[model samples]
Target: MFLFKKNKDLLEQYTKYLELCAETLDIFRKAIAYSFENGLNEHFEVLAGKVHAMESDADDIRRQIERTMYEQSLLPESREDLLDIIERIDMVPNCADHLATLMTLQRTPINPALKSEIMELLDLAIESFKYTKEAAVDCFLKMEKVKGLKILIDNNESLGDKLEHKMIRTVFAENTGTGEKIIQKDMINQVGEICNLCEHVMDRIVICSIKRQL
Candidate 1:
């Protein structure tokens, strides 16, 4: 009975952390979209602030999870797998912060190709996170729903990969001059990395769920 109660509490805490992660991803997608649409340099500062706040929230959640895990003495069959899954979820916000920092440093106009691809990547990443959050919630409520959620998550990850590869090709092909090309390349890399991290988190979630099932 005590173990059941502890598991319930831990699951609640994990769900809260997942919600926080989803909120952070939503903020990131909005900020990225706004930046591209307006091309206003000032919005970069605001976006950076949002990313920083999300990062702080993620850190707090990580600490909370650690404390709960220790206190509850809830030992899973694969502790490392569980921790990796949690850490990847935490990393989404950190990667968002990195992307915002790149935006903050930009003073000139972004390449048209880069802008379009970045927005697509952000959209796919956001969708991936949405399904991941749903999967997490469903895990606690109805484990059967998780099977469909996993498929959606996988589809989003594939979209991200396609966007990233296309963006890389476009970045190299565009003649944005030497110095400008370097800057754009770095920015594109960071944005692509954010999508990659999102996929990583989704994959970890799927793995964690499978382990739980086994």
Candidate 2:
């Protein structure tokens, strides 16, 4: 009974960590959108601070889980799976931090077309995080929803691909100055990379859910 309670507590902590990740992703998306649309440079700093806080929170959760496991002599049947999921969840915040830092360092307003593409990528990435959060929640209930999440993942991936192609075309066709073009390219790539990472985490969550079911 004590072991069962400890497992429940650990799962709860895991859920909280997922929620924090989702919140951090939302902040990241909004910060990028605001920067692109309103020329707000301060939002980037805010986003970075939030991501740092989220990372700290995730670390705390991880330590708590470790402590709980030790105290209770409890081990997950698939410790590696759980560890992987936790690491992925933590990675979301790290990615956000990277994006924010990149924006701060660049200190240049993005080209309109490139901004549009990045905004689209942020939207899709946020959506992917939403579905990932739902999938994580479903895990606790023993509900298998990988099919639904896979659909979202596919949709987001398609959006990312289209945006990438459009951005590349706009950059070269417009003959934008080489320096600015490179900056835009880097921004687009980072945003797209975030979406890709989100998809990877979702895939891992699907695996973790299936393992739990088995």
Cα-based lDDT for every prediction: 0.69, 0.71
Name the TM-score of candidate 2.
0.83
Where does candidate 2 clash, by residue pair?
A: none
Candidate 2 segments exceeding 4 Å error: 1-6, 40-44
For residues 49-81, could you state the per-residue lDDT of candidate 1 as single tens digits? 887797788788778877877776556544455
TM-scores for every predicted model: 0.82, 0.83
lDDT of 2 by residue, 1-214 (tens): 1223447777777777777777777777767777767774666677667766776776787777667655555555555566666677667677877767777776766677676567777788778777877775565454667768778887888889789878877877776688887877776777777667777877887776776666
Over 4 Å off in model 1, which ranges?
A: 1-6, 76-81, 106-109, 137-142
lDDT score at residue 158, model 2, on the 0-100 scale: 80
Instruction: Give me the candidate number with maximum TM-score.
Output: 2
